[model samples]
Target: MSLSSLRRQDAAVVRSSLALRPLALAVHMLAVGAAVTALPVYAAEPTEEAVTLDAVSITGEAEGGLSDVTEGTQSYTTRAAKTATPLKMSLRETPQSVTVVTQQRIQDQDLQTIADVVNNTVGVSLNRYETSRGQINARGFELNSLMIDGVPTIYEQPWSSGEIFGSLAMYDRVEVVRGANGLMTGAGDPSASLNMVRKRANSKELTGSVEVSAGTWDTYGTLGDLSMALNEEGTIRARLVGEYNDGDSWIDHHTNKRETFYGTMDIDLSEDTTLWFGASRQENNSDSPAWGGLPVWYSDGSETNWSRSTSMSTDWSKWDTTYESYFVNLEHTFANDWHAKLGYTRGERDGDSYLIYPFGSPDPVTGLMGGYGAGSYKTNTTQDDYYLQVDGPVELFGRSHDVAFGYTHSDQDFDADTRGYIPTANYDFNDFYDMPEPDWQPLTDSDASETTQKALYAATRINLADDLKVILGVRSTDYEKEQGNSKIKEDDEITPYAGIVYDLTENLSAYASYTDIFLPQSQHDINDNQLNPIVGESYETGLKAEFFDGRLNASAAVFRIKQDNLAESTGLFIPGKTPPTFAYEEGDGATSDGFELEINGELAPGWNLMAGYTQFDVEDADGEDVNTQYPTKMIRTFTTYRVPGFLGDKLTIGGGVNWQDSIYVYAANPSGVAEKVEQDAYALVNLMARYEITENLSAQLNANNVTDEKYMDFFEAYGAFTYGAPRSLTASAKYSF
Candidate 1:
């Protein structure tokens, strides 16, 4: 059945479910009352007795501990993060470069999606190839691993859509670790890893907020978040978050509607044991979504300058995506301070798109474009992941150290189909907006794939001296994949990690780390055999400092990365293939050298700041620049300052700027002449102001692209480009209890 038909069939069910929300809440309250009343009670006179017990020492901290929660911190940085390893450690002790975007920052910037976070994050960039899809990059490589509360999710570019558009409403913060992360993620690139920490049911009292906003391009949105204890003892708690948004884009005939819902429960079975479960769903539906972007050149081999509002999509075109995730976690703390956790996660993604791609270019005088084509595509992906981990303090040479052991298993299945169609007639560039939608053919199977990974890993943090520490880890991964007629298996692939840190002063530390990972490829060689996995190695050294009792942090780092057995296309199709396919070969690979500097946290009593600068150069073995589509130099910074005086104490103001160096791609023009399509260096400016109307009410205004910069947000070697969003404003009112 068609996705549209399915959506139609489910609409009524969804509406009915929504109508029962109040009844569901009533039932939950009743259940809580019943549980409270059923608690055992003993009313017996007891004789006075004295008991003596041995003193117990706690050794390790549990995952998602209070130290990692940034929701109530009101700061731009957290005190501790465990994304790089199972051991909870401060940023200065982690060895690798880590950046945390806290909840305060998210609200200040009005970041709604993961893409928005990435665009504002340090050392990260988003390649928004289309309106509904993007590729995240860092350190001259693509990031393929994403974690939700430490559970890994693998994303393949071809089959994944709207993953980057996941809603951030349910998250407390986003943690980014730069460089190879094989210690936790079994197989992936050396670029970086992202961990999204969810907001738990931490508040025992009924506390919540409601926000409503309106913005340019006919955008409106509402968000609500509620959290409270479900039992009198506060041992059981629950949280619910929901959002709805509808907007029209700067692009002609484009409209978008999105809905998100998330709920979680936390139950303290005992003083030392806790159970957590949550489920989330996000749906993004759009009309007239752009597919590949605008043609970059005219037929005369000259570059074409199109209006920012120009679009190749018809009114009937759309790209809709939905993501659902469910997770459960159990944690226990032993008498010796040891911590053990078991977790399971199920993730599903669905995408349905009917899009048009405009080909060729307009004639310089006639303004007539060559042609346009359309396709109806659908994809579904499901992943199941399970993990067990234990960590505790160990006595070594009479000194206490930390050690962690973990095992993980992940299974993913993906299927895609397409109903392809092509229009027979050409359309004028000026008349493209009136083009009619094409009739889509029946869907046919395009691809199907299954992947599984199992891994065991261990790490230890050893304290050699009062001022010196070292961390060592290793992982053994077993991976298997089945697609088409090809089956690939790799057993016992070992990845190693090492890091050392020395305190230079009470507030300063120096660190160095090394790690490596491998990436499997689907590309085939000339002999129709899949290529070996790419092996990546990263070496990094850095200095870190803290101030104001760890309330502020600063870091500077330099790094080098090398990848072996990288795939390079041969520009030739395999012989006797029904459908032409490009063959690939193992190349000499590439090397990337870079440096980064950053500062985050509160600079003063009412001032919060986050700023970073990044620069890198990557080259292939032939000494030619590679991955030119990504900027080699970037600066991202944002700050907020609340007024201090009596009259102005209720107001806050801030602004920021993001700048990137020029990027270019080589592609052939309509005339078949190879040319360079470039986007020069550009900077976007943003501003925000918030005022407290009362103790429980606040209003905020955010302006993005204040300068109205005209730039291409996306461009590739295919001679297509997308324009960035123009200046826009959003005003919101929020109420808190």
Candidate 2:
């Protein structure tokens, strides 16, 4: 069957699914109601009692310390997090599945980029479309929300932007909350939210670290970090971080260079007030990068088996991009233990690229290929955002509860220009390495747009009893966008959130949550009118546990996500247009049902572990599978052990494996016959070893893809795919003062 036929069949399934939503929702609500009613039986009255215990004094532990920053913590888990809600709560209290990739984990796994982090994260997947661009997905939906210090930013699709290529040297940790996050993000997909916490100037004395490394394919890199108190009274502090990396790829003529710098300062305004500011810049340049990917089939109607090092790029092709950001925050604490914060951020992104895209397939025998297209493109984007939030404890029913209120406003502008050239003559596929550059035409305006968003949100965590707690929140958003002659605006869109957590025992708890988000669509219907925004609703229930004084965390969760008003193509094009546009219609949408199990933390005195398993199925109303390109089953795990008897407890060794089930896409072969292009299930093995040479110096080595597995990193319905990296190794040494 053709791709179009598959889509039509999926649409029919969607309609059928829609007809059953009312019944499904009714049943879900009834179940929640039954649980709420049964809570009284589990609640017990508190009684005063006296107990004797050993008294111990712990040194080097501060009161009300910074639990959000996991830089100095060697454990894989944290005591508490505020990513799911503004209020600080343990993982078991948030009523959502949360994962924190701490600094220790980043170093243990040698993760250098955000893409690397996501690929190793539980229940999350990274889809690499090209060398420098990719998408992040979870729960069978693309993730579009990114946050830094609780501030949100919307990134464009992977094909158009390089946002996912950001470096991780400036961040102390990454926090991910799976499911709908409309309360904090205001507008986005229901997949997941990723928040990166920046490292701060928290030291009172001079402290720093430096590291250098060299790896396979002539790759070398260096990193430096410094922090110190600038004032004699230790009231003002500053920190600086920088990194530089250059590497040659396994693919012929492909090379990458990256540079990053970040600086931050914190000033004490008074005994209860502080001002913080920071600036960061990152630049990435790639030479001879492929525009798309290699063809999946040859002209003879047989699958093509190109070498992993094959390339379809010319020597002159390059992609150069830069990201710069500035932010300021003021925070005040009251005598009542309440806090208020005001913040502002400005971000800018610039890109310049010259690329060539190969089309059609080559003859298997002669290696002759079809024509190619080339272009020179440039893009610039700028965003300014402001927000104010107040959060503290409130007295409700003679009990202390947490509540927060906030408002945010953002404005963004984008502009793009391109020059294009197409070659009519066919060339031999074997000659792609020496392909000639095309003479591009003069640059002209391609697209320009402006967007604005305003939102108001509030949340409150109410302590109903000693073992029961409930959280309720809501958000109202006003969004608008404008282009040359078109405008799309949505006002007063309301999103609601609710969750309940009940303690089952001292070490375990059970919870449930419901939330929703709205996404505006740019597609138009047959009437030439824009379609309604898509609405996503998510329901989840889970069990959570903490052991060894919160050193280890575990969670088991089940979730279902439903989307309404999804746009589907009508197989008809708008008439009288230079470039034809497809007409679409509103469909009932799709549903995803899944579950996740995760565990992270220290299992023993000198051992740390992080592991997770995820499985989900996505189907339309008619129960037909959709989004088949994304795997339905995945497992990610890593662990490290410090040998107490070996080298006087100075050596640590670790290893991990990441596995995903098979994925396939329907595409047309070179002979115009529809076929399934699939990638078999695969796993990548990684290993690491670190040795403490002295009290203040260490050496480490990391090996990735140890099995030398050959797999595709990305695949599309257009019969193009990108290959994953082969076995590689890196060794480094670091010194601290």
Candidate 3:
């Protein structure tokens, strides 16, 4: 198809704030001001009394290695992380920018899903393709890699059942590592990596908690968690968590429900060994989901705006998704102070969606719009991932160093079925609002595919000096894929990583890193042969600091990334094909450059803060900005303060603001006129308050989009746009023992 013809066909087809009393407000203000002034100045030499606040707390033996704080706390800063490197090092020593959303933060913010957390994460942005599917981007590139308990999995449909809609009930904390993580994650972009740390069975005594919540739009949900020791010695423990959610959306005729269950067991095989096994299931169902957004332009080449609650889908449209996983792990420590671990995981995800994709712009004069195309698709994906690794001290050049080696293997299978047909009753733009449902036909087999990967990796932390360290790592991967009648294979692909960190002071450090990027490509070349995998490189330099005895952390970094072998179509057409076929070639790829500054943790004993600023630009080889529809600058911040005396530490209040620069994209109207649609700069505000009615009971309220800011959340080059969510509120009550 020619450019003009393709354009024509694409056009047709694609077509709350909280209230405050004056006296209560003044008290709150004075308390807030006092707390702010009490914060310790990070760099200045502390006075005699200031030293008391920064006192360090130490627990547990080091076991002759670096120890970490794995438990979650209300403070924004976490003591350690596994995503930055295999060795659990504090954020300040990891040589990377890391963010941790602890359990306390999750509850304080009422974050129910992965999307909610990503939206509030600094240096991250959320984009929804439609009402039901969305994606998260960091540093101007899409994030495709996710880890659960340190095990990695690539998203087959990120917008559908991947991290986008993952439940938060079963997770203890969410860890985000910015920049390239290709060293341990295998194949992925340098954008970022997200790790969901599961809540372990750590209770030595019987302990449980239950929570219930209700919010705007008739949203209601409940969560139950129980844990107990199975033996007198408390050597064996088990935990179970379950959650249910049902809610009506802001859009007309749209509703959604979700259910989740998780169970885990921990056993001590001996004083030096331990075992863990677990299983989980999650299901989501949506009724009357919008297939696509309203038209952005009229036939007259003029812009159009619609109400936020408008819907183009009928009552019959629905999307149902289910995901299940099972995992087992064994860990042991030897008398020589060496540690070893073996892990295995298997999971499956399935989704069924019935949609009506309406295309084309409406006629301004006649109010006539193009009709809709109806379709349904069901997909099932199964994956198996396992790895073995061992780390210990090695004496090289009379210096003790930490070394680790591992082998990993993964297998995946996928199948899909689809059916589509035109509705028996059709209407034009004049009757678009009242269009009826389509008569769908039976489903038929679509396609099947299989993928397998094997890798060998090794790394070491060399102690160059008492105050300096160096990390070197490399991964060798073998990959294979079989889809339909096409088969592809690649062997001996190697990716290297290196980093160095120097302590500038007891509480500050500077670091630099270089990482090679590797990503498997599914696109084929003009001759139908799978193109070479996209390979890239990244360089980053940064400074990190910790304050208040590691209770607060901050970092600033600059980075640049480049990739090649990007898939680009030739635009030449092949006849005798239902939709016409076009070949592809390895093209000059993408480049991104950016900087970020972030700070998170307890600013004071009663004050918790998280704030970040990001600026980045991505461009194609031709030097044109890519994804210009996304803002290049953003600022995010939120904080909570505990008020003393009157409430006896029973009341906590906080708020947050998110601001982004304007975004714009170029597109062609139905009349073949070129135009730009843009969303101006906007700021969203949110407020929250939680009060302890009793020692074991608490009540909390949260209001989002207090100002009811309205703006475009997402847009495409073909004249389609989606609006941001409207104002909303939620209230919850929790009981615990």
Candidate 4:
């Protein structure tokens, strides 16, 4: 069935569910009360008996641990991660460069959304297409690989139109792996993979937190999180998280409202078996979202210096979205010590926009802008994903090794429609605020696309020596895409992964890795034939170290990536099309070379620090810069220090600075002369402080862009610009038990 029909049914369901919410809440409260009353059954009277220890063996942690998946520490450093490989390994053991943003850091920075997280992450950048959607880039490449609880999923781009904007309250932490991840993500970019680890119901007792915040730009929000053991034996647990936000944008007539709900349950089926189920729903509604940013130039070939609040959107313009998801996962440990897992997830997202675009330079004589239009647009995307994997120890060649095998299947559908003549009217340039809203046309089905992918993967970690290890893996993928009358198929592309690590000392390791990339192409050649997919190789070498008994971590890495069969426009116009079409050819492809350095964790007893610096250069086959609008150099750092003995250890202070090199775009003027508009190097400074008012109450204040820097965070090749946020402040209070 069409997505529109499904949306109608879902809306009705939502209305009915709203009426049942009060009853549901009442039942939940009663259940909590009963559970609390039964807690005494598990509590024993003061025990007078003494216990004796049999053995004092201090065994090291295994590659995979239950605690690694359940609890995320607040420190800047983490001991183990599962993003690089299915098995959890120490950061020093992982060959690739990885970064983790823990829940504590998210709260300290007051990060509300994924965009905020990406912007603050080292070596990553954001490009806002509009207020409702944006893009993320790392290592000079667009990032498209996204995973939730290790299950691969694709996010709708450009429009975002989904839970991409949802609050981060539901996640334990965010992990990023730089470089190709073909072993885990079958078909994707060679740049980076982002994995969001969800919050689990692991608390054995009643524990929760509630927070409220008010910020500049009339932004205010509240969040509540609760977790508890469902029974006295603690065999079952449940957790729920909710958030609400209402805010006004820096642009005139722009406002945002968002709501999110997430819940999960964990059941211990047996001593060695477990089951998990989770569901979430989110809605993000905005009024007067920008179709694009402010124009860069006037018709007279002079630059336009507009205020940050200058908005080209009409009061009637809006972009609203809804997202929902459900998932289940099961795991069992065999008698032989091997572990097996099976998981599945289904997700749906829909959005509608009453949009207006004013896309031209003003008339030099009449000061009138003619490129105006309005339309009603609707889009929906759905995804179903499954995975099964098993890993255990096996003796080989007189040595113990760990091996893992897995299968994954994913199906995704996306569709969009639009109706009406946009810009029903145009007005003079200076009359933007007084311009009337255009009567939008009705919406109808326009186009649809679908893709399905299946893969089988396997990997092994060989302990070649006590201080040496090797990882070998491969994934065989079959992918298919259908768009209108065109169909593309790629059968069984084998991508390989290889890595080696050697302990340089007790606290550090030296490693190198090579990854094969496989990405399907959507571009067409001169004759309309689909271009061959991009096939590439990535190489990297790095040094990783741990300090203070794993409380601190650092890494330095250098890498290079090369891809072939890249689609490049020939700059020639075909005559038969309605207007004209540019022909494309599989050209020389592109290359990127870069290096990164990062250090994070506690520097001392009372101080915490996180710092990183990165630089890269990218060029197309012709040796021309591919994306000059992205900075070639960047440095970001932040640190916090606690006041000892003063104010009873209740006061903490922190600050950070983010700096980037100049970036520019090439555009043509009315006279057809190419000119460059550049945003010079700039830095943004931020300060934060927190104070505990009582045993269960605390307050924090955050000030961003303290320098009040004026700069463009995103610049389009065609002269559109998205300016960075100006100076703003937010203060929040929280209570926990």
| lDDT score for residue 428 of model 2 | 77
Tens-digit lDDT track of model 2 for 1-737:
66667766644643453332333443443453344334323124432211110000001122123233255657787766666777657777889989989888999999999888899999999877677677788988889778887778544422265677789999877889998888888778888989887777777789999999999999999999999999998779899999999999988889999999999888888877878889999999999998888899888887888898888688899999988999988877788877788989899888899988888888888888777777788988888989888878899789988888889998889998998775659877787767777777778999898888899999999999989999999989998988877687889999999999998777778899999888888888877778888988999987777766666788778889998889999999866643678889988787888788788887766688899988887777666677777777899999999998989999999999999988777777877877778789899999999999998999999999999999885557467888889999999999989
Please give, for residues 1-737, the per-residue lDDT of candidate 1 as tens digits. 54334333433332233222323433443443344235333234432211110001011122323243256556788767778887757888989999988889999999999999999988989877677777788988889778887767654534657778888988878889988888888788889988888778767899999999999999999999999999999889899999999999998889999999999988888989888898999999989888787888788877778898887688788899988999888878888878888888899888998888777778888878767777788998899989998888898898989999989999999999999775767777777667777767889999999999999999999999989999999999998999997787778989999999998878778889999988887788888888888899999887777665556778877888998988899999978765778899988787888788788877766788898988877766765666767787899999999987945599999999999988767677776755667789899999999999999999999999999999885557467888888999999999999
**Candidate 3 structure, TM-score to reference:** 0.89
Model 4 agreement with the true structure over 1-737: per-residue lDDT tens digits: 43334334433442343232323433443443343334223223332211110000001123344223114344766666777777546777888888887777888888888888787788887777567666677887877657887777763332456344567878877888888888888887777878887777766689999999999999999999998989998879899999999999888888999998999988888877778889998888999887776777788878888888878687778899887889998877788878888888998878888877776788756868756766678988899998899888898999988898999999999899987664444577666655676655677778788889999999989999999999999999999989887687889989999999998777667789998677887767777677877877788887777765565677777788887887788887644654566777887777878777787776665577788987777666655666667776789888988888989999989999999887767666655666667789899999999999998899999999999999885546557787778999999999998
In the range 34-139, model 3's lDDT, one tens digit per residue, is: 4544676555553221011000111112434433333424666676776766764677777777888777778888998988888888888887757777667887
User: lDDT scores for all predictions?
Assistant: 0.81, 0.81, 0.76, 0.76
Assess candidate 4 and give its lDDT: 0.76
Model 3: lowest-lDDT 10 consecutive positions: 50-59
TM-score of each: 0.89, 0.90, 0.89, 0.88
Give the Cα error of residue 105 in candidate 1, in Å: 0.3
- Summed over model 4, clashes come to 5
Residue-level lDDT for 177 in candidate 3: 83
For model 2, give the 10-residue run with minimal summed lDDT: 50-59
Q: For model 3, state the Cα shift of residue 214 in Å.
A: 0.5
